[model samples]
Structure formats: structure tokens, C-alpha cells
Target: MAFDSQWGLSATGFYVPSYEEVLDSIQDDFIARFGSDIVLTSNSNFGIITRMMARREKASWEEQQLTYYSAFISTAIGTSLDYIGGNLGLKRKVDEPAFATITIATEGEYLIQAGEQFATESGYVFTLLKDVVTTQNNDGSWSGMGMVQCEETGADTNVPINSITTEVDPDENILSVTNFEKAGGGQDYEDDETYRERLRMENEARPGSTAAGIRSALMNLPGVREVNIVQNPSNATDKYGNPPYSVHIYCLGGDKGSIAETIADYIAAGITLVGSQQLKVKDATGNKLDINFDFATNKPVFAKVVINTDDAWNVDNGAEDVKQSIADYINELEMGDPVYITRLYPAIYDIEGVTDASIAIGTSTTTLQEKNMIQTDFEAVTCDPDDIEVVVNGL
Candidate 1:
């Protein structure tokens, strides 16, 4: 019987004939065909020439060619796959900055001119875009002219306020201002592979897309990470100003104000607003602001992990790893998603010493629903290292 296919251990990989073996075979063939008198040994000139020919054949065919073939399959294939995805439209998401309004209080009726700068104690600079002049109304109540649009200088503009604190300007006449609301819109630039995936989503969109279409578009914006577009959420209250046939978008990432305004504007452009269905809003001072919606507070939840390990071990170190694993799992949870206590079990069991784990999360010993129609870029429910408790049982 003869073998038509290439001989190999497995797949296309094959073992090549060595130079010494081929040389010996060639000598045996020559001796068998010629007579026993024609002896081809190592000292013979013909034997030397045969060995040299064998070496050349082995170097070219077995060493060089086979090595190249193996590498071409193992290494370049990954790059080729990436090239294919690039052709299919995959790209990374970019970063965005946060915006805030800082009030510049005056000792007297001072005019906080536009472009006036205020700095936090830690030197976070906030600047005003337009002049905010002090004004008195007929009702003896004052409004506007105090709040100023402020952006962080340079790259680091994102910061959260413990409470609404008034910041003091570097110079006099400017009191303290704190960004009561959490600052958002800070994100790292997406890498090549991540960008590619985003592009694929857009390419796959149809002429008339579904909720995923809106999500894809919103995710493309800088600083947006997670998006959940629930259409006609009539089962719940008409919260977040969502009317019948309306969509309740729960976004995680980006500046709350920016994302809120962007969502309202995008919908308003394509749809008509009539009757009492107005998107217009006014501030306390009767300044007509665009749209009607607001960001909600981040709901806090706690997690306790009880693991039954076979024996006692370095639980303190193990606990840190367990906490990080749980945090990563929670971070990936979608906006408005109910907390799954069982989800933490897998994360805790992944730790080396944990044989089994019983995890409890939130205030009660059950799954908790997410609130806040719009969770800003940094407002997702997170478990601080302190928030997670890890106990090893069966010691």
C-alpha cells in the first residue's frame, strides 16, 4: 500500500527525513543496484559528496521550508484575522471631558465677568464662558448671573463633588463653589481592536434599526460605555418623563447633562412635538433650557461573600483578589439591571482557596433593582474594597 497524502503525526504537520538517514538510504540503494563490490563508506569520495547533497536537501526542504510553513500558520494567522475585522469596519471608542456649572459668589454686588477663573483648593480650575452679572428682580429674589459654565483646564476635568460646594476664585470677590453633581465624560481612548468592534455594530445596522440601533449610536459617543434602551416601559411608573410608546434609556458613562441633552435632541429632531408634549424646560429663573430630564443618584449596594474552603489559608490576600473579581463582575452589569446575588458566587469560587461560596448583595439578602434613569459615566453601582466582605468557612 502507498500513502497519497503527506505523512504527519496530526493535521498538516509532518516529520521530515533527516540528512543522515537520507544519506544512509541513498548509499544502500547504490550498493544494492551496483554490486556488493561497490562499497560506499564514510571515507569514500562519493560518500562524502552524497552526505553534502543530503545536507543541502535537508537544509532547504526540512529545515527552512517546514519552519516557514509552521510559522506562517501559527503567527501570521492572527494578524490576518485582525485585517479581516478591519475590513469589516471595527474601530475604538474615544474619550470625552466633563462639563460643570460653578458659581462665583461676590462679596458685594460684584460682576463675575465671563472668562473669570476659580480654582479648587487642590487647584482644579473652573472657568466661566460668559459674564455672570448680579441682578435683582422685582420680587426681591435674585437668579441667574451667579452660575457660570466651567470646564476643567488641560486634560483632567472630571471630578465628583461630595456636596454642592461653592469654590473660591484664585482672586478675591469669588467665594467657594463645589460641583454638587458628579462630574463625568472622562474616558480613555479606545484601542484598535475595541474600535473595530464598535464599527462592526454600525455596519450591521439595518435601514430601520431597533433599540440596538439607538444603543450603537449612543455608544459611539465619547465617554459612553453601557447603554440600555427600554421601549414602552409602561409596566413601571412614567418616570424620567417617559410617556407611552416612549423609550427609557439608562446610560452609564459621559457627562449626565451632555448625555441627557443629546438623547433629547436626537429624538426631537426626528419626531414632532405637539399639544402638551413639549421638550422645553425652564430654570428656576425662567430661563428656557432645552428638554426636560435630570440625572439620578447612584444607588449603593453591599456584598458579603461566605466561602467554604477545604482548609485555612491566606484569607486576607485571597480576600483582596476575591473583591477585585467581584468588582469586575459588577462593573459589567448593564444599566437598570437587577443585581444578581448568585453572580458573585462564581467570582468568589474562582479564588484558589474557595471550594464553595454563598454570596449576599445589597441591603436585603436578595437581588436589588437599579434606579436612576440615567447613570452617568461614573455613576454605576460599584463595590468598594471595603464594601465586600469575604469569610472563609470550614477552617
Candidate 2:
């Protein structure tokens, strides 16, 4: 009877979809775009979890975008969860990327000396070739004066050579090799060969034959770490081309300022013997004479100084100390640091007491201490009452 009453009302039934059908509808679309290797699940939530797990596994194995994105999302979720659970990871990574630095070191005085030597050599060579004087008379006769000019027998070019086997003697006025050569060329052909040989012999007898001697002289100076020298034959047409030379000095590690100053001082003290013009020999009564002399001058020569650190950026823990020492050295030498140089890192790092909590707590403590000191009797002096009372009683 009751079943008949229930049947009189509207009939109702439950509809349950198949797991395979639902999974095929949703997961098939996902797999078409993503891949067929993806796993299908009965539950939507379970399908999502499976997809995430698959992506994470793939990402872990093959550093692909899908895997990377999944891992990043997982990490974000995991980190959030861990933070909520109060489990922070070990240490935060420093933001600075890795890099390397270079530094140079040299002495200023050494650089100056090298430069001066270069200049002196340049001048000597220039003067030797350029300062020639020729006198032409009305009879169409040409006479050359100054250093002796010798004619090359084979080359037909004028060569200058000193005649004296020793230094130029004050009493003797022997013809210059250049003059002898020219005279011999005009007088007899046999004399030309003799003069040419004499010029070659004189050149061979020069004090320093090779550029190595000049480089050695530079190296002998203080604070010179490395030295390089170069020499080339000057063009015969150019004034200084007759005897050309070049020098370069490389100082690896030293006080550049001090070195530069020392070089300048040495130059000022006239340690280098340079050419200058002087009056010819004269009698006691001051009679005019035909001789000329090479003298020394006090004029300061031009030089260039370059100072640098050997390796600036690779200092150890003691870098600051070393850098300070370098700075002090520079100051002592009276030179400023180069503009390109800068502090690679902070002079000091607060690693001793730096913690997330300590920093916050220390800030609060400092504020409180500062506030309390504002109204304190900082200027008031206190006397002991017992000591005062004893003093009064004794009085």
C-alpha cells in the first residue's frame, strides 16, 4: 500500500557518469595539447595532481619549460607551506653574481727616467744628423763646418767620426774624421777608403754599442721591476734619423709616486750627462778661439710616469690592509690614485653580529637607550654625604 502511494508521486532516478568517459573528455583534450603519455585519472582533483606530479618528474629529469614551471610552482607552494609551518631553509643566497678584477702597479720615478732617457737619446740622434753648416763662396766653392764629415767610399754618403783615439785633446786641433773624409775625397781616391774605415772603427769604439746597455742603465734605477728597449736606424733624410733608439720600462710592483719623484730628483741633480753648448778654449787674456765645447745644462727634461697595480682585484682577506698600504704609499709619493680605480667591496662587512632578529632587536634597543639618555642628569655631579659629614666634623 505504501509503495502504491509513493508511485503516485513523480518518479525520480540517479545518473552517475562513467570514470572512463569523464576522463576521456577532459584528459583527452589535455593530452592532445600536452602529450598522450600523460596519465588519466577518475577524479578531477586526482587528475590535476597526477598532471602536476608528471610535470614535476619530467622537469626534474629533463630541464624543460613544463618541468621547470611545475617545479617552480611546487617550490613556491612548498616554501609557503614550510613558512606557515615555521621551517625556514638554511641561508639565503647572496645576490651578487661572480666576477673577476685586475690591477696594475708601477713606480712614477722609473717611468720618468725611462721617458727622459728616451728623450735624451732622441735628441742626441737628432742633433748628430741635423746640425750641419755649409758655407758657399763667390768662387762657387762650398765648405762645410761643424762635426767632421767623412765620405763613404762605396756609398757616396757623408759620415761623421771623431779623429782622436782618446777624448778630444784641448791642445790638439786634429781634423774631424768627417772633414778628413771630405778633404781626402777631393784630394785623392785612396784617402777616401782610409777615412771610411776610420769612421767605421770609431763607431765600433762607442761606449755602448747595443740598445741593451741603455735598458740596463734604466733597470739599475730603484723600483724598476721590468725593462724593455727598442732601437731602429733613423732615416738619413731626417735630422735625428742618423742614430735612432727607443726605450720602454715596465715596473710590476712598487710605489710609483716615489719612483717618479726619485727619477725627477736624479735628473735635477744632473746624474745624467747631457749635451750643451759651451765657449771654445781661450788664452789667459781672453783671446777668441775656434774650439767649441759640450757642457751641461740645469734645464729640467720632460718625462712621463705611469703607475699601476700588478693585480688589484685578487687580494686575500688582508686586501684592505694591503690596499691601505698602497694608498699610503701613493700619498707619500705625492700622487693621486687613478680615477678608474674604486673600492671593489665594502671596507668592512657587519658579519659578526648580523642576524635577521639581532638587527631588529638592536635597532629597538638603541632607540630606547637614546630616549632614556635625553632627560638624564648627564651634567650633574654627585658628592658623597658621608665624606662631607666627616670633613665637617674634622673641621
311-365 per-residue lDDT for model 2 (tens digits): 3323342333433433332222211112112221122112121111100101122
**The candidate that achieves the highest lDDT relative to the unseen native structure:** 1
List model 1 lDDT by residue over 178-226, tens digit each. 5555556666666544554565566676212356765676676666667
Model 2 root-mean-square deviation: 34.2
TM, every model: 0.56, 0.15
Error of 1 at 240 (Å): 8.9
**Candidate 1: worst 10 consecutive residues by lDDT?**
269-278
- Where model 2 places Cα greater than 4 Å from the true spot, the runs are 1-213, 221-325, 328-339, 342-395
TM-score of candidate 2 versus the correct structure, residues matched by position: 0.15
